[model samples]
Target: MNADAVPGLVAVLAVTVTTIAIGTWGLRFSRTTSDFFVASRTVNPRLNASAIGGEYLSAASFLGVAGLLLVGGAEMLWYPVGWTAGYLVLLVLVAAPLRRSGAYTLPDFAEARLGSTVVRSACSLLVVGVGWLYLLPQFQGAGLTLESAIGAPRWVGPLIVGVVVLVNVMSGGMRSITFVQAFQYWLKLTALLVPAMVLLVVWLDDGRPGSPSGSDGAWSVPVAGEGAIGLYTTYSLIIALFLGTMGLPHVVVRFYTNPDGRAARRTTLVVLGLLGLFYVWPPVFAALGRVYGRELVAEGHADVLVLELPRLMMSGLGGELLTGLVTAGAFAAFLSTASGLAIAVSGVITQDVTSRFVGERGPTASVAAAFRLAAVIAVSVPVLVALLSTNIGVARSVALAFAVAASTFCPLLMLGIWWRRLTDAGALAGLAAGGLGAGGAAVLNLVGVEGSGWGAALLAQPAAWSMPLAFATMVLVSLATPSRAPSHARRFLVRLHTPEVLEQAG
Candidate 1:
């Protein structure tokens, strides 16, 4: 190993050890099934918000955004903006209502609202699909981080991070990870913030330098694309990022841990602030990269800018220490986010697949056992895929996950919460339409399909079209089959929309 790699390797080891230690500490609280699933639905807004920030700011936010900005320029700002604004959309529309649904998972909400096993099963499949899709990038990112930090083989990072996350999830489930994630959020923020502050001081100490000469003029443009194609791509991305948060199985699952709808709303409010604060630093790193690390952009290694910038700007002990700090944060990003996704997917699998064999009224021990088994299965598939699949831009891959979520669950959630006339038939139809559209596009992209013109643009960003198609299909199908609507729809809506105070008084 290179001498310089020692700090990074030490940082990775420290983070891994600390994560396991924290998870084991949390195991003391993870006795019952409820404790395993949703922290017994008692996480306060502040703590829950911090945990949300930890998991939600995945590899995409930590590394991909700055890299994209370094190469793609100001237009990439939309990624962070849309990501943070997503919580805003959730706060206003979905958070409180979703919490009030009294469902443990998205599939639970689907079944409760639509009163159909078929709808619930379809939702379960989608939750797993989206979870795995999102987890893919997290795993891939782990490999990239390890490769950049310590010259470890790329496969080493994914396997190590995956195993660490699995151990935590299997040990205590959501309750265990809640503490771990909450701690990681602050660590990630500090990891990025301190280095950024020091770099800014260094830049000021030197002159604030301009972009390197002969840079592409397009790099300065804030818009991602030009003309109609640019506008379409930008809007499609915005649609996905803004609406997709409510549909992300991991993100939505966090809401279930809140004590009530009111607390869920409060949690989202705090999350918005926390996310906004965290996002401010990535762009700073991108701008600094333009000055100090422009060669990384040319080398197509911009993803490592956050990890590399600290060492480049300073040398000796300080640089190595900062490198180690950011490396720790990057590993935390993979672990925390992967842990959340595992919990969400495992909950669905335990409920839908494992528990069926055990019977619905099985002992709590049986249920927890099923959850642990499902956690292993939930994480294993993604690790294998990350090992075999071709690497893509982490942020772009995550955006596709968002698009899929936007196209499928976003419609299901919005109408399911606000529209009483929605029926199982409508939900199923909308899911198929949106899922096939966006998912097909994603698959094609994954297989290295490429093209130009509007066809390529549409495939690259399907949300603008697919999301509307889903909403329209759901509405039209429901209107056509009013008799198929759930008899309990109105009652569920009442529960969802009613303030907790009113429900308590009643």
Candidate 2:
């Protein structure tokens, strides 16, 4: 191995060992099925908030944002802005009611709300779809980070990350991951924050050079220079990120870990603060990349800006140490996000697929065994996909996942929580419409389709049209099929909106 790579190698190993050790420690509290699934619905607000931040800030946030900003300029800032604001939307609408639903997964909420096995099954499929879609980027980003840092072959990183995630998820599930994720959040924050501060000081000392002259003025503009297509794409991306947070299966599962609706709301609040604070630094990195690492953009390697920036700015020991710090953060990003997705996907698989074979009333050991088996399958499929697929930009790929979630589940959660008219037929129709619209777009993009027409722009960012299509389909179908509405929806809404104190008093 290159001596220059030693720090990165050491960082990778340290993160891996720390993750597994923490996961193993958490295994002690994961004896019950509920513990494996939702931490027995007892995670406090601050702890749950930190865990949410850890899992939510995936490789896309760690590496992609700065890279995209470096290449695409001001338009890409929308990514971080929309991502942070998404929680504000979630806080106002979904968090408390979702927790109050007493459901372990999104499908549980659907079935309870609409009272249809078909709707439940559809939801189960969507949950797995979104989870797999989201996992693809985390795995790909891991490979990218490893390749950039230590010259590992592209495939090695994904395999290693997949295996590490599988071990953690299979060993202890949600209860175990909660502690692991919370710790990773702080690690990730420090990894970026410290380097950014040091880099700023260095730049100040060196007399603050401007970005390369070859950079386009358009890079500073908020919209792409493609006129109508640019505006449409920007709005679509905004819609996806703004509404997508509540729809992410892993994110939704975190809310279920809160003890009650109030705790859930509090968790959302803390998460907003944590996420806002974390986001402030990526742009700093991106701005510095413009000054010191313009060649990375020219060479089509902007994704490594975070990993390469510190070493480029400072020499010798200090630079290598910062490089190692960011490398560790990037690995933690992959593991934490992948663990959450695995848990969400595995829970759905165990409940909807594997449990049928295991039998529903099986012993706790049988259920846990089935979940472990599901976790292995969940991690393996995505690892293979990451190996086979071309490397799309990590943030862009993750945004596609967000778009799919927004088109499908956003409408489901919004209407399910607030509207009494959402029938099983309506919910199913909305899911199908939204899934086909957004999923088709995602698939096309994944396979390397690209162009500059309106058609291309639509496929590139489907949330603007697809989300509205879903909401309209749901509302229209519900109006037409009022007779099919669930009888218990009224009571369920009361339960969702009522404070625990009010319920207890009555």
TM-scores for all candidates: the values are: 0.97, 0.97
Candidate 1 per-residue C-alpha lDDT over 252-277 given as tens digits, one digit per residue, 9 for 90 to 100:
99999999999999999999899989
Instruction: Please provide, for model 2 over 1-506, each residue's C-alpha lDDT reduced to its tens digit, 9 standing for 90 to 100.
Output: 89789899999999999999999999999989999999999999999999999999999999999998888876687898899999999999999999999999999999999999999999999999999999999999999999988999999999999999989999999999999999999999999999999998898898766853223554335455667778888899999999988899999999999999999999999999999999888888988988999899889999999999998899999999999999999999999999999999999999988776665555788889889889988999999999999898899899999999999999999999999999999999999999999999999999998876888889989999999999999999999999999999999999999989898899
| True lDDT of residue 228, candidate 1 | 86
* Pairs in steric clash, model 2: none
RMSD of 2: 1.8
Deviation from native of the Cα of residue 491 in model 2, angstroms: 0.9
Error of 2 at 2 (Å): 0.4
Evaluated against the true structure, the overall lDDT of model 2 is 0.93
C-alpha lDDT of all candidate models, in order: 0.92, 0.93
